[model samples]
Target chain A: MSESPQLTYAEIDRTILDTLRPPTGGYWLAIMALIMGVLLGVACWVYQIFIGIGAGGQNIPVAWGTYLINFVFWVGIAHSGTLISAILHLMRAGWRNPIARAAETMTVFAVSIAGLFPFIHLGRVWLVYYMLPYPNQRYLWPNFQSPLVFDVVAISTYLIVSSLFWYTGLVPDLAAVRDKATGVRKKIFTILSLGWTGKHEQWRHYTRGYLFFAALATPLVISVHSVVSWDFALSVVPGWHSTIFAPYFVAGAIHSGLAMVLTLLIPLRKIFRYERIVTMKILEAVAKTIIFTGLIVGYAYGVEYFLAWYSHSAVEIEAFRWRALGDYSLEFWIMVVCNSLVPLLFFFKRVRTSIPWLLGISILINIGMWYERFVIIVGSVAHGFMPHAWGLYRPSGIEYGIMLGSFSLFFLFFLLFVKHLPSISMTEMKETLDLGESHGD
Target chain B: MATDISVIGLFPDEQKTAAVIEAMSGYPWLIDRVHSPFPSHKIFDALKLKKSPVGWFTLAGGILGFFTGFSLAIYTALEWKLIIWGKPIIAWIPFVIVGFEFTILFSVLGNVLGLLALGGLPDFKGLKQYDPRCSGGHFGIVATCTEEEQDQVIEFFQNQGGEVTIFE
Candidate 1:
């Protein structure tokens, strides 16, 4: 952990509480804009439902397009939340104290948004319940042996567990908010807090419960993305069928996830004036971790090419070659430059510490990660086994609109989260302050 | 029957509150509960509480979840008896993935349920004695006493440099 910020317990409560006071005109305007974007996406989805799945640009050999790409991309974005909150907590990293709430909130919102893509991808959105394992008159149960089924189960579990973990951590802070709030707000928080009194017994069980949830979330986060990868890996498509897909996808997920964290948190810190709590030191540590994940992502790219050649599989070689130098080569190289090259800037201290550089590079990484999924999902399928079936794919305007809506929805939820709840873990910050004071004494 | 009263001692420092609890160890039952803005290992040690059994809840849920997952997959597969692509009727590998997800899902649910049950949460009664300052910087120790011992308890708290409030 970096040097503890000089903050009193009361000050911590006051500052965090101040963030929840009221939404300003600017905040409302941002909300209005996001809602408009969400409506546009919704309208496009409705049009697609009415016109049939043919409304999108997906065609034979490229059956999976932007929807699947968005699904995988958003799922990847959710990974760093668990990494920062659960894994860091287990490691006892104190720097995570300030950012953990936001990351975990991001996880819940991102995963929720990611959950929508599969449904949107299902053109007959109404019959989506067919994926559920229920006995019906038709006597059909979802194929447990299928990777898609695995995704449904894994992602649902991830959402539930992540929600539980996030809510568990929020309880004490909710109680603090309840205490500070009045009238309707107090009643609302009182109910939300479930009447938390922070008694010794409550704390004892609460601590144990939080630890258990974190422990569960660690493996759950890993498995969720692995299952998402299996959706492609289990296929016989040349570029998709790789044993290294799980770890490669996992690394890429965290890489993008950390970038998204910076992208959101940098602006958040500036707006909320959380500079004291979310110190530069913490951001630097995050950047350093990004470098590690980024290298793994870069290494995965090299290994994919190496293995394609090393295996001497003609189809795999063609699939990879077409990815880099074919119709979608621009996206492939962009993914490479943005994900692998952009993050390398963090190796320079000036880049890591500079907010503009960090924000810019992180944004590039987000774009790169999105394209990374696009390359892997669309690029692989577009040029698979049968040379006669080889074709190029491009997203329709509807697809683009829907993707825009998803981004707006994600930011909207995050905005609401910051305004309604304690964005920082007030209880944890107070504990840190108390400990720091004692140490100084 | 003698009416019982509760005397609440609010301390500014958690360490001082913990010390008071330790000094009054001979009358451990007198310390009804200690409330703080954060979890205090110091007070927990002074009180010498037992470890929580929430993990057992997690273990039970995990075992149940594994069986539930495997059974659901196996029964459904056998009921159909339909084979796909020459794959086995009961594929354990894919079923393991389902089982693993369920195990985590149920375990987390169990952990939360246990937390609520063991913590006696959703108890509005506890809030009556709760000082909002406990959520800020103060540490409050609530103790139960007989009418005869109320003065003695207040004096004890006052002697420990605590501000005392008596509730009848």
Candidate 2:
């Protein structure tokens, strides 16, 4: 019998926009857990504000603790969105369009969450914007060449561009929403969409323009992460001074970013019943990307050991030794197992296809990536060449609280975003299904 | 209706779509309506340029993004001097990265914003025309004409083997 049920675009759009409507069981719990974590994290931040930076971990040598760790972790995690949307777009892979928005959202949220770290760690959130180069009465200015300063510019640029890319792709979809919206949603969509009429000529130029922007964004990801790597490598510190830092960081960023993409998407696909658009095929492809990058990351770790041993530099050798069996040795071991070993599980096709395992691995990888950064930052600096100067880094409650809150903030934004937009490209899906219709004599 | 009108139909095919476009070059008031099972990318060259401002947006956005990026980097580095590796306070070469990232990011954003603005998207008002089928698979064409010249246009469309609809 021919299929009696024909789902229209309206139904799809409604489902996408209505993701948050009085959930039944699982979704409600997830949302609740996210909200609770965020609230608790906020409370922790409050506790930290009263007590100061002492609540967490930060000492003489290891000045950057979990706060900086989270910052680097999240930034690395943000790169895949641009990689997927821009690189895949440039490469003309059709599977990218559906998943790109989700990845890009992850990037923006991760970066935004990461961006707040400096302030959270600063113990002075109000003066954050004072980091901007505003010509003031004091004639104060910042050094233009610091990698951290470069990171500020790079991360901000990445955020703005990525946001615009994701939102711009949403214009037509937003227009459709505006058309169906009855009240405030309609007004919001209308304004956000800017009155898209979907004329043929417009579509023609739109595709061209979108493609152009994607091409532009592809390289930005490479540069942004390299710059982030430079923040450490540019320094004269023993562990941070390796020339391999750029490639190593880039590979690690991609590794973490892929994990983040899977972590966010696997659950979403299951919950929203988006199996058709974000099919198992798409997940499998992404799994392959993860595996490839995982290998790269594992290799990068190997390279680090090789260079340190081969270079015969005392400081490098000492840094490596400390990382493996240092005061914070546990973090280093966790990073190796989580980042290197867990990813190896993906080599089996069965493991890659299993959503539960993917989620587990993704979560573990993120944790591991965070640990990796901590190991790199803290392991090297906390106990330097001078034994007497060795000091432990304990982030104040504020730093730790903000770090936890950052994830909550990201989830909160994502939850709100999913509720307003069509998570899947309805039009694209329809186009895919219409091949038979086109062949009718 | 034009008394000299002619009607012709062709099986929807790319070769036919191309033929119709090629044949239309003969008629002064040439109007050929070609139907396709799907939207054809080739039709664009047949009908191009709708005055889009996305280019300007991208250029401006990229500039803004780069400036802000470099500016932010410089600002932050100069703000305090708690040496990490005992390096100098004014770190310049390292800051080049931040500047580069901002430039790419802002420009890309501008392009997207410009595209949105140019496309006139997010229009809430349900349009009068454009059946949902238009978004589906139908390729529709509306060729306007006077009663006297309708016959010539129809003849040209017919010779090119196109679907011609006549209404008064």
lDDT scores in order: 0.90, 0.70
Local accuracy of candidate 2 as per-residue lDDT tens digits, A245-318: 88889889988998888888987887787665566667777788888888888888888888889988887888
For candidate 2, the per-residue lDDT at B114 reads: 63
Q: Which residue ranges in model 1 land beyond 4 Å of their true spot? A: A1-5, A435-441, B1-3, B27-29
Fraction of native Cα-Cα interface contacts (under 8 Å, chains A and B) also present in model 2: 0.39
Poorest stretch of ten by lDDT in candidate 2 chain A: A432-441
For candidate 1, the lDDT comes to 0.90
Q: How far is candidate 2 from the true structure (C-alpha RMSD, Å)?
A: 6.0
Alpha-carbon deviation at B148 in model 1, angstroms: 1.9
In model 2, the runs with Cα more than 4 Å from the true position are A1-29, A394-399, A427-441, B1-42, B45-95, B113-168
lDDT of 1 by residue, A47-74 (tens): 9999999899999989999999999999
